[model samples]
Target: MRDRRGQGAEPDAARPTERAPSVRSEGAPAPPERAEAVLPEGVEAPPAADLAALFLLLANSALFHLGEGPDAMGEAAPVDFAQAQFSIDLLRLLREKTEGHRSPEERRLLDGIL
Candidate 1:
């Protein structure tokens, strides 16, 4: 039978299948690339550019200052409404700046966080 391109099936079967190389061999676990690439001790990892992660971080910070969550250090600090307000304002600014650019999921997440 001829394919849509008018090529015979036998001719196509004789051609080698082209595919990208696999990163790992069969039955082998994936290499720990991220783990092996370590930085000097006490050095912080590079800042992430993920909008969702940033949003969650800001939300958590705000909640922590507002006494609704624990600090990054896991300590319960006194409530600071002013600081919380500032964080929330920052989130609002992000929403404004990212208007018409965010995916539906991102918009929904931001709205829910707000």
Candidate 2:
């Protein structure tokens, strides 16, 4: 009697299964290598100390009007004493907010900056 499923419906155990085609071509070129980042002239990547120092410098510039030089386009900016005081106050707030979370060294540095 004929099978009820239909003729040739059963998977042939002797035949090899077909595979999907590869996505990459065999002759494709290798991917390009990544290069190191280039920083601006006289500027190195910032370290942890540099970040703290940056805030200090900004506060000093506000408080003492230092580092007020001509811009890249030769334009000079007027110093705002009020803005500097605000930055100093913000730094104070940061110290208070981060109070128990900082390491001894970090706390010392922050305290010195403040």
Candidate 3:
């Protein structure tokens, strides 16, 4: 058959099937999907420049030190009250220093975290 470029073309049956490229490197198995990777309908990703996200990140660090979060091996680490207190203090100082520079929602979130 003649292709659009007026060149001879292989018969359809003789051509190899095409596929979408794999996201990973060649020969690598596809990564498994984790429930945390997907957001529920109508939910949106956190904004890149969000102050609320920064507040939440520090809060989570405190929670981790308090042994409420998993460790590197996904096991609960021993509670370290000092570290936890430090994290909370840092978060508080950040909120205070950024006063009047945050949106109403960001201020509310920071207050709630404290």
Candidate 4:
């Protein structure tokens, strides 16, 4: 059968195929580059900034003042639990990202947490 390129061949399913080229190559000619495309107005990109400081600040504050239980105001309940969950999740993410390069302080905190 004729392929899309007009090369006469059997159907791809019936033929043994070679592997496709990798997206990146070693010592290959650089691909043509394009100008950075500006985002359209109102397009919201994900925030790629340090949320750690904020998380750590709130976590520390809550841990210090909240005293580890649901209190008279009940404000501490959700905030404390949510902060704990977020810190645990963040620690897991950090471990996965760093592949276990955590600092001693981080390890201590994470050990206490988990």
TM-scores, one per candidate: 0.55, 0.42, 0.56, 0.28
Worst 10 residues of 3 by lDDT: 2-11
Worst 10 residues of 2 by lDDT: 63-72
Per-prediction RMSD in angstroms?
15.4, 16.0, 15.1, 9.5
lDDT values, one for every candidate? 0.86, 0.67, 0.83, 0.58
Worst 10 residues of 4 by lDDT: 46-55
3-37 per-residue lDDT for model 2 (tens digits): 75433656577457798656757787766875656
After superposition, the stretches of candidate 3 with alpha carbons farther than 4 Å from their true spots are 1-47
Residue 111 of model 2 has an lDDT of 80
Where in model 4 is the C-alpha error above 4 Å? 1-13, 30-34, 39-87, 99-114
Pick by TM-score: 1 or 4, better one: 1
How far residue 102's Cα lies from its native spot in candidate 3, in Å, is 0.9
Q: How accurate locally is residue 61 in candidate 3, as Cα lDDT from 0 to 100? A: 86
In terms of lDDT, model 3 sits at 0.83
Ranking by lDDT: 1, 3, 2, 4
Number of backbone-clashing residue pairs for each candidate, in the order shown:
0, 0, 0, 0
Residue by residue across 1-114, what tens digits does model 3's lDDT show?
745653338766777899977576788886786455577889997566567778888898899889897888988788999999998999989988998898999988888999
The candidate, 2 or 4, that scores higher on TM-score is: 2
- Relative to the true structure, candidate 1 reaches a TM of 0.55
